[model samples]
Target: MFANIPTYWCAKCDDITQFSLKVKEPPQFTFAIRKAMDDASGPVIPYETNYCDFCCKNCGQPVRVKYDEHEFAMSSYRYLPKAVYLYEFAL
Candidate 1:
């Protein structure tokens, strides 16, 4: 159903990964998500943090990237990269 969403490269898995909105997993947030998506004027909450999680469809390894809806216009949304950064949390 979400095949055409977006894709990014994962160095750990050494392959391209698919993207998914973290919010979509929760049933309660569905209405908020829909509202945000339906709003043509702008994101329901400007500056809202939307996590764009990219994971390997094969191994299931995943990485999270932060994004703000106000960062890009709707027309430029498709051009956004699936992976923004590879975070190294602990030393």
Candidate 2:
């Protein structure tokens, strides 16, 4: 069984709706280093970060959700516009 997930207001849908959560994996890169004395390659290194994306089921609009943190509790969550979120993240 799946745990209860709360629905949020989707402006595009003009009503409350459930959102689908998708996790995006960061990009990976590989580098090669050559030694001055010999022609050899160095080890490969990988880096990545976790990112979450939410889409409204009714309207299929993407939104970025954030929780408001108070002194010791979370007050509420806000849906950020896709344009602003994309600009902020440079995605």
The C-alpha local distance difference test score for the whole of candidate 2 amounts to 0.33
Clashing pairs in 2: none
Q: Report the lDDT tens digits of candidate 2 across residue range 1-91.
A: 1114645576555867553323321121112111210122112122111123444556645443332212333644333222212111113
lDDT of 1: 0.45
Which window of ten consecutive residues has the lowest lDDT sum in model 1? 78-87
Clashing pairs in 1: none
Which prediction has the highest TM-score against the true structure?
1
lDDT of 1 by residue, 1-91 (tens): 1235556666676777656654343332344443443342233244454555344566554344445543366554432332244333234
Q: Give the TM-score of each candidate.
A: 0.41, 0.33
Model 1, position 36, has a per-residue lDDT of: 42
Alpha-carbon runs more than 4 Å astray in model 2: 1-4, 20-52, 68-91
